[model samples]
Target: MEHSKLSLARRLKLQQLAIFEKVVETGSILAASRALHMTQPAVSKSVHELEAQFGESLFTRGKRGVKLTEFGVLLQRHAQSLLADLRFLADDVNAWSNGVSGQVVVGVLISASARLLPRAVVRMHETAPNVIVTVRVGSNDVLFPELARGVVDVVVGLLPDNQAEGTSGNLTHVPLYDETLCAVVARDHPLAGDPSIDPHQLENMAWIVPTQESAAWRSADAFFEAAGLVAPKRLVESVSILTNLELLLESSMVALMPHAVAEQFVRSGLLSILPLRLASSFGKVGYTLYAERTPTAATQRLLQTLHEVGESVRLELIANSPSTETR
Candidate 1:
């Protein structure tokens, strides 16, 4: 007689699944048992039972402890995700039962917080008042690690060109808007007065650029590389949005900034935008969300709000652009 597929009830128990995951992570059953407050024999029995049910050896006992077999590795991968979801579900249900919503921690780059994040937060408050939203601002290097450790529920910024590298598990990305880089200069600067400035004219000018490690800097580097020109010698490396804007106003240096950010300064007449035509395909900026694993319902709702707010902001910017003419 052929063997039947394992039923939900017959499959590995939560304790067994947890033990397998801990063993795989810690590289030893004894360590896993210690962490879970179970005896070594019990941990060993759980692994043995799972292997018997699957009709294959799940671990290879070795001098270095126990390592997973191919089948064991596969099971561990799926089991880890399952366990995470179950934990999140439990926490969410408990919060709901207590008449308090769970919290969603979000990571955002500084540039995004100005318009994108605030609008999203407002929408979230209006829609899910009980769910608390926490926002943390930093570069991707800082935020991605936090995301991986489950410190933050999601990250919103330009999607790294290579999303798969340096990540352990799958991440979800949703494109919200595309951003373009523009030159920001003080209103009194010569370039600011020009109706349109050529890109080559910026070759010898001093530039206030972001640190080389920042996403903005990377985007700027790619743009320069595509143009067959090196970025102008940096007069200052600034990560703070306010400091960069202030530098443009206090000095003759031109700063590369997103069109939306420049627009804010332009409106106040503190800075002016130079209409320099860059390569049509230079750099496309957009927002992305990264999670160590799948996101929760509350996190999903917040993401939806972000996309909606981004669309609204993009439309408003386009409508107010000088390029647009009244009928």
Candidate 2:
């Protein structure tokens, strides 16, 4: 078979592929060497070897740094795609060795549905029935490290922007959807009836805010900062939207929530969205997965499931315009 011919060319192709990717990423030979922990000479030699193989220079020396030649730019793009495919292949192979038929661990945010995950698991079972699917729920702060350590295969949550700071080269993110933040209050709350409320008016109201560690809370803080007001003094901190909703239901406290989760209660007339003009820069809300490499076959399939579920729910809410629904 053609696949059986995994020769020297193939092996060198993979090596050069990695080197070229790192060089393009770091933007210079010295920087690439530091990242790859190779000497500058070795890095240069590797690049030269690759150019020799292709019978063309992949990069040109420049004053600011090394710039990719046209061929190098083209190769960089294709190499990244090829490397991703190779990583996927490797993950598939690992899945087979690690008991192709067993429980798969999934990490999720507290608000995600069991139904959402089960649909994906069911699809996997149709093809690989022996694989048991298990789930763990936590905030991204708790899950990111676990995912990095291989304790969880994939995580579904809004990854903090700062979470990327020290990840080195071990993490990748695929945004599932953007969730807009909105204020959640009881249907009869003073601000609920208004077409739109100003942020400053909330300064005196009791607030049910997530702790500083949460992405939602951070966004809420940014919102207040943008309004030139501090977060309300009498605040109740909760980690999950479910808890925040409970707090809003039993008290006059208002909470910040993603529009999708807030929609559920708002439609039931249990909660009403405040007509406040929030900062358009409240930052994006989306599902992020932390994987050491590209996701495994099962993990990739699970991610696809998550994307499908999230998109379906988002589209439903958009079409219904839950924000416009009356109690």
TM-score of each: 0.62, 0.57
Score candidate 2 by TM-score against the native.
Answer: 0.57
**Candidate 1, residue 98: how far the Cα is off, in Å:** 8.6
Which residue pairs show backbone clashes in model 2? 196-275, 197-275
Q: Pick the candidate with the highest TM-score.
A: 1
lDDT of 1 by residue, 211-321 (tens): 878867777776666555676774688767888877777888988776666677777878887765552121333444443356676776777787788788678656644
Alpha-carbon runs more than 4 Å astray in model 2: 1-102, 110-131, 162-168, 279-282, 285-294, 313-327
Tens-digit lDDT track of model 2 for 1-327: 132245535646687788888999889999999999999998999899988766778989997779999988777766766675665566577667863554456777633533345555666676666655678777777777666655577766555663432343566665554555667798877667887567777788888766777666677777677667786888887766567767787888878766666667767778987766543233433445554455666676666667777677657655545355442
lDDT of each: 0.71, 0.67
